[model samples]
Target: MTFIALTKPQMRGLLAKRLRFHIVGVFAVSLGIAAFCKFAVAKPRKKAYADFYRNDDSMKEFEEMKKAGIFQSAK
Candidate 1:
């Protein structure tokens, strides 16, 4: 096994290559976090409410309350 010492230019090139790899890694991690938040942290409020109100009994009760002016805004 032979030990080799890097020259200044070689060291500079190696450092630049490592810097580029680090930048790419940071961007990849950032994109992964963004994608995770986009997919995993989203709450489908409209769809959830639609599903909740799709039940027949609840729909009937809501309509009855509306008919009784329970949801009317005061003038």
Candidate 2:
């Protein structure tokens, strides 16, 4: 006479199963990415940007300021 729907227990069990599947999918994706990085591409090394400064004028100014104790001047 009446149609039956999912009960609380049935809904909870379904949600639990779905959550388990999602967790497993995430783990599988993470493993795939790690494997790809390990076998496909080598990690890049650190590149120095300090090469942009050729003469080091900023360095000399810093040393001069330190000698003159300009940082202690009251502003």
Pick by lDDT: which candidate is best? 1
Model 2: per-residue Cα lDDT over 1-75, one tens digit each: 998996655644798899999999999999999988866664331122344455458867877887888877622
Please list the C-alpha lDDT of all candidates, in the order they appear.
0.78, 0.72
Please list all clashing residue pairs in model 2, or write none if there are none: none
Q: Which stretches of candidate 1 lie over 4 Å from their true place?
A: 1-9, 43-75
Q: In candidate 1, how many Å is residue 18 off? A: 1.5
Q: List ranges where model 2 is wrong by over 4 Å.
A: 1-10, 43-75
- By TM-score, how accurate is candidate 2? 0.40
Candidate 2, after superposition: displacement of residue 33 in Å? 0.8
- TM-score, one value per model: 0.45, 0.40
